[model samples]
Target: MSTLKILFVLYPGVTHLDFTGPHQVLSRAPGSETIVASLGGQDIEAEGLTFTNLADLSKVDRCDVICIPGGFGTTAAMLDEAFMAQVRRLGADAKYVTSVCTGSLILAAAGFLKGKRAACHWAWRSLLEPFGAIVGEERVVRDGNTITGGGVTAGIDFGFVMLEELAGRDYAEAVQLGLEYAPDPPFHSGRPELARPEILAQVKARMASATDSRSEAALEASRRTEPA
Candidate 1:
């Protein structure tokens, strides 16, 4: 059997769980190989950890799957025309293009989400429609070749879903068992809908600030693309 090559796109300040969680599940699949690709062959920092000498995006020629993770950096990445072009090119060549959290924002900026049903973090779900996507609030949303997940931890579920679609249900089940996929949140406040009203309000306020900043960045990027 041919090995399935999976490419992971990363950037500075990416959320650790967004990529790592999915990687933990996908890497365990039989005949699967994973590679970390970045804008350049330089080290990037994420959640206080440094990943060194990852594959340069410019050099990636092929991949069975492409996974894009989200974090604060995604706001900047969505604004980078060169980066979006690269993503568009690579994503076109890959069999499956997937993202977690606000990473879908980058894919949208690349013009890859056109007419696709996609999911993103609850904090930024409204933004996807501007890029021509039908927004889905589900933890894992699949629209044709595009798969998106909500928030950080959703990557795990997204991975299993993709695994089932790509490999098989049995393969996905075995990997889930290997990871001991059981959730036991210490509190019932993990989801925004289930959280206390005061807590939800606070979280929304913080997310609003981030959203404003992301909007500004996207606008700036759009301005840069305008004919001079």
Candidate 2:
């Protein structure tokens, strides 16, 4: 069988779990090859963690699947012409185009998500609107070949969904079983709607600064770029 090449695009300040969660599952797919890359094949500082030995984004020609992860750096990434250029290049012909968490904002900035249903981290989901994306509240939203996941933790669910689409239910199920992919969160506060009022307010306040900055960036990116 031909290999399914999967590219996980990375940048500085990325939320590690956004990429790694999906990477853990998708890398195990049969006949699939995973390529991790940064803009310059340089080391990446993801939150407090560091990732090295990444492929140069510009050097990578193509892939069957292209995955972008979200982080505090989404605003910077949105404005990066070179980074978005590579993203557009690889995504233009990829069999699947995907993103995690706020990564959807970057994709939306690329003009790929205009009028397409996509999910972003709830805290920043509204930011997708300025880019003309149909914001979805679900953990994962698949519109045509473009799939987007909500928040950081949703990448795991997104991965299995992508796997099922690429391989089949049986294959995805087997992989899930092998990974012991069962969730039983200790708290029922994963979402704003579900969290205590005080808790949600505090969390929202914490992200207020980033959200405001990203909202402006998203509007700017939307105006400057056209849908590809």
| Residue lDDT tens for model 2, 1-228 | 678899999988799999999999899877889999999998999878999999999999899999999998889998999999999999999999999999998898887898899999998888889888899999999999999999999999999999899889999999999999999999999998899999999998898877767878888898877545
How far does residue 211 in candidate 1 sit from its true spot (Å)? 2.3
What candidate 1 gets wrong by more than 4 Å, as runs, is 219-228
What local distance difference test score does each model get? 0.85, 0.92
The digit string of per-residue lDDT tens for model 1 on 41-156 reads 77888978888879998898889898899998988888776778778888888899999998998887777787899988887887777666789989999988899999999999
Model 1, C-alpha of 140: deviation from truth (Å): 0.1
Q: Over 4 Å off in model 2, which ranges?
A: 226-228
**Which of the numbered candidates is closest to the native, going by highest TM-score?**
2
